[model samples]
Target: MKNLRLERCGITQYDEIFYNLSYDELFRHETDAALPDSERGVVASSGAVAVDTGKFTGRSPKDKYVVNEETSRDKIWWGIGPVAPTTNNSDNQQISEETWYYLKDLCLKRLNGRKLYVVDGFCGTNEDSRMRIRLVTEIAWKAHFFKNMFIRPTAKELEGFVPDWTILDACKITCPEPQRHNLRTPVFVAFNMMERMTLIGGTWYGGEIKKGIFSVMNYFLPLKGMGSFHCSANMGRDGDTALFFGLSGTGKTTLSTDPKRLLIGDDEHGWDHDGIFNLEGGCYAKCIKLSPEKEPDIFKAIRRNALLENVVMDAKGVVDYSCDKKTENTRASYPIDHIERIVRPVSRGGHPSRIIFLTCDAYGVLPPVAKLTQDQAMYHFLSGYTAKVAGTELGITEPKATFSTCFGQAFLFLHPTRYANILGRKMEEHGSQAYLVNTGWIRGKYGEGERMDLASTRRIIDAILDGTLDEASFETMPIFNLQVPREIPGVDSGILNPRNVWKDKADYDKTCRKLAGMFMAHFNNFTDTEKGRALVAAGPQLDAEADAAYSSEA
Candidate 1:
């Protein structure tokens, strides 16, 4: 095998490189070879390799930065509003050309003399639109992770396959001179879109690598007239495709992995003139509390060659999926083919006939399921409404309302309105229906109300896909102006209106008005644009008299 050395880049002083090693080779290297103290190779009960990412188990979104170069400065979204001190503030600083070069040099230097592992793969599954990628990491497990996460090339396809983009993962390297580097922390995850290269250092979290490539796709795919989505998709027996959009904890993965439906892609995808294509070759699913009964496909997918991150296991290698002692962001990375029923070719699928926006509403004010008009769809799409449940992040004990534009704010490159407009146009052209489903609290607030039963949520989703809900009588909800169905097959009629389920109707009304106010307040961030204005008009309306009456009662 020809070792592709980075010495050609004029930075590597050493000549060692392991290029395109097979799964067995990587496993052997990680398990038998003398690895770093930070890297631990543990075998799970299913014979899969499991590793712990110390300190940083989840993504450090604030640390992610995009170089504001001349070619991409105007095209990139530099984030709006005030920067929060504790949040990932990638938009806060636009690194100078000199600084980017300096960081690249540092990353390459860190790789020198280290046993580098390189994995060559493709990003998009569509043969027509696929982009070749080469990832160089300091650890063998990361190489294995990337191999599973990205589309692998066959022997014939791998011959002379030049990468269109490259990622240098120097996870173990940390900058000792933070002041000289002008960094808030010793670690950094920076992307230079102009160079089509990403540099990651000072963190061991593998998600940074996965999402870094996604960020690149989010930027470049739009210029090609493709809509890049942070959503999951699957197709039915009748060739009907459905897209599920939501953030972490919002059932995007679980719902999309329907046993009856053929999985298209989970997490990220790109929609073009033809149809949708999977952006990845694998699934990186949240495995905390994962059980076979709840998600058999995902549960069974964790077999040999799968990589479990931060999952607690006993001395005998039996995994305890319920444990979140390490971190709530426990994950499992496995190849897409691991699942029994998946769309063959895994590249492309027909345009979706139904679009579902999944949200976890802690406030319990939103309806269980609501049919959205075109305008309302665009409005909700931009708002990206959801609640950040406790324990997902540090210091967040109670549910907090969050509005990430396009449902993947951390990975967005262009203005959110751009993606929203594309979606609206596509929905209109294809006559696709949109629905908002809240798989969260019911009757009262987070502490007072119980979660919507997963079985009920599944039934609602089934109805949406089979067109059963289309025949049900609809009623307009107050404050939010949502058109909710009066009845469904499996769900209780009393809970449909939300207010009926609450013992204190006045409290429910007050909560609804409060949520409506929150929506209007968050919408103010985009009111300057014409599309934003239209979306605002489509949102929930608050009544002044009702607000005063509710306030007086309080």
Candidate 2:
């Protein structure tokens, strides 16, 4: 075997950096050498290695930034407005070139005289469109994490593979000059599109590393005439493919990993002229309350090579997937091959026949499932509506409504309407069908209403895939203009219409009107263009009486 070293890449500053260590080597170093005593490993019941992220569990969205430079300045979307920011930051502020170089120098300086780990990998599964990536980290576990999260190259492919993008993660290096760098805190995650490099410092959370790469793919894929998505995809026995779009806690991973279907990829994907391709080589599943019975594939994937993040464990090395003492975003990263029933090729699949937009509507106004018109589909695709439940993040004590355009507002590089336009064109050209499924509450608000049963949701999805739901009688929702089915197998006909299930008819009407108003308010951000106008016109409509009633109630 050939030796791995940074010298191969012409980096003379670091002489002791270990390049492209195997999984076994990474695991050994992680457990026995790289980590501190407090960050030591624990063996899970299934034999996987588990470790806590400490203090910062979930992603720090606020800390993420894109450097403002001439190379990609005009093409980039800047600042959050009536429309949500593409970066998902409240102040999508762009730092100066001096600030970016300063941070980069600081990160590189921190790695001096320190042992580093590097992993060479690919981002896109489509061989023709994939970008080579080099991940350099200060911790052994991060190298292991990248090894599991990214597509691994075979020995032949690794012989002379030069990276197109490089990510330098010096997680322990805090920026003391936060004020000068225009950072909110001592931590920073910044990406330079022109340079094709990502810098991470002051935080050891694993998600920063994953999402940093995702942001880069989001920027470049669209420019290449491909649509990058934050969704899970799968193909059926008959080669029928489906895509599930949702934010975290919306069951994108769980719903797409069907026992009957073959998993293509979870989390990130790209759609191009040929078909849909997995942007990642593995699954980073949320492990909160995980169970063998509920998700056997993901549960079993938690084995020797899987990397557990922020999960709570007992002194005896038994993992408590149900424990949230750390955070609700506990996660596990494993290669797609870990799942026994995944699709062959595992990187790319046929163009999707169906696209499902998932939302956990806390207001309980949307029906369980609704067929969308082409215009309505574009509208909802741009809206990307969902509710954030409590415990998913700090300071969120109840379900809060959120609108992330294209279902991934945080990682977008261009305006969301641009992505929506591409999706609309593709769906129209391919003659694909779209549906809206609410994996959320019904009949009442969050605290009062019962969550939509997982079994019922699954049955609904099965019906859609099998072409049964299309045969059912459909009724038009009053405000949203959504086509709601009157019946579905394994689901009560009453629950098909959210209003029918509500005990208080007046309350349901009021809640529905309020939600409609909220939708209108959010859509106002994109009403400047002709396409935007059409989309706004396709959304829910409020009558005079309902508007009056809602106003009086407010």
Candidate 3:
């Protein structure tokens, strides 16, 4: 098998190529590049190397594309396209095979005569299911990022390392002509599944590289009948494993890195008949407004060799974690081993005993914590409901409801139902309980209500993990039909039920119905099949009488 062959990808020229450098070596090169003259990066007070992503600080979903060739054209879930533009509305936008090749040649030419840093690593920790990946980039920090984020090979393993897939990240390059290439923007993240290659340009956001591989695994794992998840997993001392599913800003990484429990993985995982395994070797945690008091595990992980992206620093190079002047998506990338508690050697665990679906409900209409039936688990999984407040996105003054199917629509390749089916079957087979925990607000919407305290949420999560909540009495919530616990050990009973804490009960009822309607409308995007209809019933309902009765009961 060929190993580290850039020539095979049609590039004959490069200044220098370094392969699998140690963290110290990469850090030396990174700091050198950040010299006074070069605007690359600097060492922060915490000893982490901090760099700015310039224009793009987050993943660009719209610019992402998949080559609609014979191998994947029929299999990909290319959802409906826009009426006027003639492109899919989904994140997996379609690009012709010809256009993909055109961009490939451009990417190759841009790397010519430029220094390249190549790193070889594994994606999944399970040797049986993991994919050997090679990342070739021009930036030393990016090479470091890939090394920190992926499972590093040992000295013996690196001898014959051949990547199952490869990513060519030309962070400093962009297409010269979007009109001629028939592209939306000069920046493009085009993937050709048949070729087992991904081409990235115009964005230095390291997440694009990390998540691009995840999309590859999402496609392949499902084909192998294994479940790929955009969630966090950890194991308790009692041998109980739990998975946390949610979108960004919703505590997936923060909550799952429990000090008491052994963290299996923080971001992504895969589940098969055997069990679940961590997909990546590291944690890419959002560190905006990060504090040691709130998140002890993640805070301490930011030490020497950790990579901080787009985080603001003062004149003396001390990091201001609360500053969002650059972007609200300030992040820190560090290997999982940085944490004090974790599953050693291999990050794999038994079938999860419980699954928690986390959502930051800015509207504050949903109960703080609610239990779900198996069907409801699949329904909520498909819905993947979460809300974004004013500052989270570009142009939001109010809380906007966002639903990314399966909590990771951006990375999914197959239909949403395919993944939902696998989850439902696995849950039924293993008897895994599901719960939805809202960490957003308490009394009212974003403007009026206070955010849920981290301590209280942790207490609620502890109850679920320790099996205390299972014995507590549950009451049905209106419209959503979620079963809320009557009382939690450390949590106030008044805040357990959302309506009880709301200042205006009638306004609460109105908001609940509006959110329910949004859920129903969003579910319409899914195909109308027998299973689809069944899962639909598991979601929220809007009945006038039910709302009135629920208001009076509160």
* TM-score for each of the candidates: 0.94, 0.93, 0.94
Candidate No. with top lDDT:
3
Clash tally, candidates in order = 2, 1, 0
lDDT of 2 by residue, 1-554 (tens): 35555543334476467778887787778888445864566667777878777767877777777788999998777764322333333234577889888988888787766777888999988887888999887788888889888889998899988888888888878899787666777888888888888888888888887887888888888888888888889999898889999877677888888988988888899999888999988889888999999889988899989989888777777788899887888899998899998878656788888999999998888999999888898899888899866674576545667988788877877877778888888898887799999999987878779899899999999998888887789987777878999999888889898987788877888778888887888887677667788788789888875456445543
TM-score of 2: 0.93
Candidate 1, residue 139: CA error in Å?
Answer: 0.7
Clashing residue pairs in candidate 1 are 62-88, 62-89
Candidate 3: give the clashing pairs. none
> For residues 11-68, could you state the per-residue lDDT of candidate 1 as single tens digits?
4655567888898888887776466546857878898899988899998876766786
Per-model lDDT: 0.84, 0.82, 0.87
Residues 504-542 of candidate 3 have per-residue lDDT tens digits of: 988888888888998999888764656877788788887
Model 1 spans > 4 angstroms off:
3-11, 80-93, 389-398, 545-554
* Candidate 2 off by > 4 Å: 1-11, 33-35, 80-91, 388-399, 528-530, 543-554
Arrange candidates by TM-score, highest first: which order?
Answer: 3, 1, 2
